[model samples]
Target: MKIKTCLIQDSPVFFDKDKTLDKVEQLTKKYAQQGCELIVFPESFIPGYPRGFSFGATIGSRTDEGRKLYSEFYKNSIDIESDDIKKLEKLSRSEQVYLVIGVTEKQQVNGSLYCSMLYISPSNGLLGVHRKIKPTGTERIVWGEADGESLVTFHTEIGKLGGLICWENLMPLARMAMYKKGVEIYIAPTADSRKEWTATMQHIALEGRCFVLGCNQFFTKSMYPEKYRSLVADQPENMCPGGSVIVSPMGKIIAGPLFGEAGALVAELNLEEIGLSKLDFDVIGHYARNDIFDFNVAKQPEMVKENPTPKR
Candidate 1:
């Protein structure tokens, strides 16, 4: 089967959920009109990424200002079962296209938040959600840890759809688990916009022998507060310049390095490439050495405790 994927490279609505959804709706319509099968959006597309500063840092450097800003932003975040998700589901079905988009998810019970990716089917049904295993650095202060039970790949009409959020792509064990499940299309939604980020995606594509649909946001210094802007004024060009790209199994750039724009890059992927690329160096195939180096990963706490820890 041939898969057509589009990456929505755009600036998120800085800390505003309603405006972000409005932008998403418009972009979804545009991509659907163009006959794209699936569209991938950047991380924290809803309510915007925190950028580099605390939410309400201006009120006071210490005290309740930072907490107040976080609370406000959290309130703006979408609940997984909210009306907005229903609207997005309807849009996906009406457009007849699969959507793999990221959002800031707020838990209804405890009011804690999570960085989550939602997979909406063209049938207007909830497919799956993968929360970031670990929030990067300062993000930990605002987001909660994801449950180990949430690691899963959704079986969609398009293909074996699975993904890891942002820096989770750097986790070797996580990548191997996805590979074990035979993921054909690996969706990587990220906030990293450095020039080397594209190279990292290309490397993952070649290593997994699967199509990598890497989508990143196109943001700028203006996206954040002036206090935050002053710190990175030296390299303003890459504050969050979108370098979204799609790579084929052979590590070829098929779609884009779509920098400095709020748009999508559509690419047609020939599924045959997966099989073609894996013929030589399939990680689980002839290339694997069972006797010499057996790498085992266990999830159960009991199993983990029993196994010998590897030396650094």
Candidate 2:
């Protein structure tokens, strides 16, 4: 099967979930009109990635101003059950394209947040969501970790699509689990835009022998509100310089390394290459020696949370 996919590297309407979603709608229609089958966005592109600002927080000190900033961030985040998700569903169906986007997903409970991915199908509406199983570094302060229930792959008209947020791509067993489920379009939505990030995508495409779609946001100090600009004033140009890219089954860059730029990088992918490449080094098939490696992926992450013997 041949499919056209788009990676959105545009900046979000920083700190405003409603405005960010509005931008997403416009972009969705723009690409759908250009004939994209699936469109992916960067991590936490819904409201924004709180890149540089610590919100006046420290190890043991969260000031009143910090709490106020956190509250503002919380208010700007989109809940999974919110009208924002419904609007995304409607956009996917009306645009006739699959939608894969990253957002700061607010939980219904006390408003805990997670860096989440939404997999919406044109025909299936909102198929499922993949919440980041673990937050990286300082991210743990704001985002709550999810159980494996969020590790998911969705079947679509194009192919079997799935994703992991940012550094989770480094999870060897997690990648194997997706490869085991036959993920063809492996979407990675990340906040990291370093040149090395592109290499990671290429490696994954080669390792999983699957098409890799990597999306990142191109953010600058100016992207933030006037009041918060001073907080990011010391930052350099292209604070979150984009490196959104797409790699083929052969680990070749077909679309872009769109570093320091913000736009859609679209490419037409030949899914047959997946099967052809798998014949050479199938991760789970002819290449596997199950006797030497006994791996288990828990259906419910909670079931194995305490097991802690290095499993996804």
Candidate 3:
């Protein structure tokens, strides 16, 4: 089966969830009209990615202004059960497309937030969400860690869909976990726009014998609210030059590595390439030596307990 896919490389209406979602609706409609079945948005495309802002944290000190900024950010973040998410789900159903997008997810009980990938199937209202298990670098300050429960792959009509977020793609074990799940469409919504990032995407496609879709936002300092522009004043105008791309199972760049722009990269992915690519190199199959190496993911709490915990 061949699936028509689109990767959106555009910034959001920073700190404005309503306006950002409106943009999402508009873009989704535009691409769906082009017959794209799977449409992906960049990381944190709902409200926006916090590019140059630091939430005011020294080793032992915090600032009130930063706290206020964080409060504003939290307000803009989306709750999974919120009408904003429901709107996205309804859009997927109405457009008849499988939608995958990155979001800043807010916990209802606590005020904590998570960088999450939300999956919506046209046939199903909402599929599920995969919270970034480990937020990279300073991201740890804003987002909480996700448990094994979120390291999941969904079986869809196109194929088995799964992925890691941004730098999490560097985690070999994490990639293995997805490969073990037989992921055929590996979706990576990332903030990394460095040219080197494309190499990583290609490697994942080759390693897993799966198609890889990498999406990122093309953002600029001016894109932030005027009041918040000072936070990124020292940085260059172009904060992130979007490096969205699509790689085939054989490590071929099929779609793009769109940079310095706001647009969509559309491509048709042949599912049969997955099987052909694996015929020679299947990391979880013919290429793996499970008998020699004991690998485990915390898919269950007890799975972690299987190994002895070191004394603190």
Candidate 4:
């Protein structure tokens, strides 16, 4: 099956949920009109990525100003059950497209934030969410870690769709879990726009023998609010510099590495390329030496108890 897909490389309405969601609605309608069956957005596309902000943190202290900024950021983030997300679910259904987007998700009870990916299906409403299992570097200051429950893949009529967020794509174990679940279309919604990032996408495409879609935000320092512009004054004008791209299963660059602008990269992915590319190198099949390498992903402690290795 061949499916038309779009990767949206655009900035969010920084720190404003309503405006960002409105943009999402408009973009979805625009692309779906162009016959895109699947549309993916960049990491932190809802209320922006917080690319160069410190949020007032030092080694031993977090200043009051930082706390206020964090508070503002927290206020703008949405919960899984929020009306904002429900609106997105409705958008997917009405547009009749598979939508995958990145957002700063909030836990209502504990006041924790998560860098999360929402997978929406036209017929299924809200399918599921994949939270970033690990937040890279200072990201831990703003985002919380995800347990195994959020590590998941969704099987759709188009293909087996799943992915990691930003730096989570670098986790070998996480990639293995997705591969074991037979992910055919790996969606990488990220903030990293370095030239090397495209190589990582291509490597994953070849390693997993799956189509890869990489998306990032085309953000500028000017996008920051006037009240907060001074905080990012030292930063360059182009903050994120989008590098959205698409790669075939055989490591071929099918679409763009869009940069210095906000736009959508569209492509038609032939799913047959996956199987054809796997003819020689099937990571989970012919190439895997299970007897030589006994690997397991212990999501729960109970599973650990089930297969205990001998202790010295």
Question: On lDDT, who's better, 3 or 4?
Answer: 4
On lDDT, the candidate that comes out on top is 4
Residue-level lDDT of model 3, residues 64-168, one tens digit each, is 988998888899998998898789989998998999999998998988999999988887656788899899888887899898888877787767888888988
lDDT of 1 at 114: 91
In the range 1-312, model 2's lDDT, one tens digit per residue, is 899999999999999888888999999999999999999989999899999877787888888887888888899988878788789989998998989899998887767889999888776677788899999998887889988787888666688888699999999988887887778899999998899999999999999999999999999887788999888878885699899999998899998999877888999999999999987898888888887988778772321111111334
Task: State TM-scores per candidate.
Answer: 0.87, 0.94, 0.95, 0.95
- The per-prediction CA RMSD against the true structure, in angstroms, equals 8.0, 6.2, 7.2, 7.1
- Cα error of candidate 2 at position 309, Å: 42
Clashing pairs in 2: none
Clashes of each: 0, 0, 0, 0
Worst 10 residues of 2 by lDDT: 300-309
Candidates' lDDT values, in order?
0.80, 0.87, 0.88, 0.89
- Model 1 alpha-carbon drift over 4 Å, by segment: 55-62, 223-238, 290-312
Alpha-carbon shift of residue 301 in model 4 (angstroms): 14
- Model 4 misplaced regions, further than 4 Å: 300-312
Candidate 4's TM-score reads 0.95
